[model samples]
Target: MTTRIDRASAGLPPAAPVRAVHLGLGGFHRSHQAWYTAASPEWGIAAYTFRNTELPRALEQQEGAYTLLVPGAPEATEAIGSISRAHPGADRASWSRDLACPDVAVLTLTVTEAAYAAPERDADSATGRLLAGLRERFRTSGAPIALVPCDNVPDNGAVLRSVLRAATRDDLRFSGWLEEQVSIASTVVDRITPAPTPRDVREVLDTTGLRDEAPVVAEPFSEWLISGDFPAGRPPWELRGARFVDDVGVYQQRKLWFLNGAHTLLAYAGLARGHRTVREAVGDDVLVEMVQAWWQTASRHIPIDAAELAEYRRRLIERFAAPGLRHELAQIAEGGSQKIPARWLPVLRAERAAGRLPEPLVRGLAAWVAHLRVGEVRDPRAAELVGSARAADPVRRTLSALGPDAGADDELVSAVGAELATLAKAGN
Candidate 1:
């Protein structure tokens, strides 16, 4: 007998005019960008999913209003109304139309890192889709726009620009327009949003007297550091704890090597230890020690002050152990092939070049090998990774799969092999 969440039921104001477009409309987008934009009532988002229509359909049914549950001693739940429209990825007409609109000042993306690797002409890829939208924008209004990539790739803004430039190299006029009219912004976004459980739905129904099919549950913590220009205009995201920095690289390095690196370790190591959620994994003393050790190795590379790094680590541990945030290891473990190179290899190579063997980093690599051996994790390169894991020289072959010259380092191979032996002996 609960009401469905909509503008009226949630007592929300009328939907704001759509001034932004978001691709990869998922849980993280709900908890992060959309939430930040909620503080700027004048700017609304036209959100589109990558592939699935289920979420978009459900959200559209609810009039793009959904509950955001922040679990704590006193849980906070609010109906988010920043999404003015929700459409499936197949709605290319709407996507192109929206991007072509002169009023749409910014476009944000949460598509995974893998999406960036797709050929720019591959219509199914995120970059391909973006290229198409930009073509539409260029042909129609030729209005300036900001492209903000919210994924975890390093120097995401530059990466996007590079890919788009390569894509449009054949068309000099369009290329010139791209360079002139588009501003690509790099960003560091943080929020731990777990997939909503049925229990969460029931809780939303009980507490708010509304059924929210698209509710997102997240930790109270959130951060967004952006670097670039918005020529057309943008929401005052800074007012909602987002920082506009001159350079996002340092902050990006801190987040990538610290928080995401630890999560990668926890994903592979914790899952091997039979822990499911991050909360469960972080509670284990063994996993906690491993995370601390990994953080120590990664911290050496980040340019942040030691005191601030220590505090960030402390806060990270607390966030990982936050109650009711059932952040799944399986979810994090899905893209090890893409993640390890970004999160671990930088620290590993740096430490190695310094004449130091990073044991914790190596151990995390071993855990990834072990996870691959089990053949449970989902990865775009799963078949190849599994083949390498089960190959004649698994340690070397697996390392080779991760990076071009990784296995060529005999010392690294020997160390990883030894660690793999230890894991096998422990039956992990």
Candidate 2:
């Protein structure tokens, strides 16, 4: 019989003081940041689940300890004990109190790219809620703290600061305090943590001999590179293979243009070709060629050494082809409009400026447009853009979704149009 996991069952000491608060309490956090924090036994995380309350409820029931199932040559299950408490995302009182509490020194976020939209004024937005909490902290304790954004967006720290500044522009004192007291840290995070399957849940019981209602499954690989100061203090994350660097741009660009860009391409192009996961899509010759073309074009801009990039590419192939991961295309396909600007547009413009029409970039954009043309799009701007895709010419729709320059470039438009035609012929 499997025993339910809790602090008592696990024979844990009294919960550590909550020194860190995390937004978007999802699988990636369990596999990555929380795992890192678990290395620092003194620091406990008050993790808030995003949108849904079920995970938080389940985790709270388990006393914030759950199993982490890592699939590898020999799969392993380990209990993570970093989370001191789990709260619903809508717990404004708890969120505000945590931010103001002197003990909470770091605030980490994993809300995806879509949450940052119109962050300046939307008091109800994720960023807005963050600002509200920050305001409370400033008023109550005036404590120094770091806000780390662990998202795929480029220069995520800078982007978040700009949004916070815009949101607090009217209050000079608050904005001044923000610049003086807050540290916005950018990060590059990589880990393949798929949504837990029913099989995974049963396996947790069988393998760990514990009934963990909210167990997370991830691949063995994990990486985190952060750049910024932690003013108040921080968990000793470096002990857990996390790199604290002065500049994260190099690593950030490499991840965005390579891993994330390729994922986007596979999400659209691969799904358009009848494949459902990265593993299946990558096995196809056409998709492989498309990925290679994208990497070659994007490699021109990455500042890293060629040898390192090559190794990274090889590792990527192995990671993407990991059958156990089963990363869903539809999950990666979400927020295309928000994602494309960061993933594909920079390389597209750079290639255009260098006097070449990059075929892979064109195809990726066309695939996105084609994706919009077919099914219900899962994006904040979906209503406007999907209608535009249906109402306008294919090339025009591509340009409208991307930018004016894409429309003006005759060669680019022609290339994108050709890709659209090919996708149409494929009945995608």
Best by TM-score: 1
For residue 348, give model 2's deviation from the true position in Å: 0.5
TM-scores, each model vs. reference: 0.98, 0.96
Q: What's the true lDDT of residue 37 in model 1? A: 96
Tens digits of per-residue lDDT for model 1, 97-161: 99999999999999887898655558789999998899999999999999999989999999999
- What lDDT does each candidate get? 0.90, 0.87
Error (Å) of candidate 2 at residue 417 is: 1.4
Q: Candidate 2, after superposition: displacement of residue 177 in Å?
A: 1.5
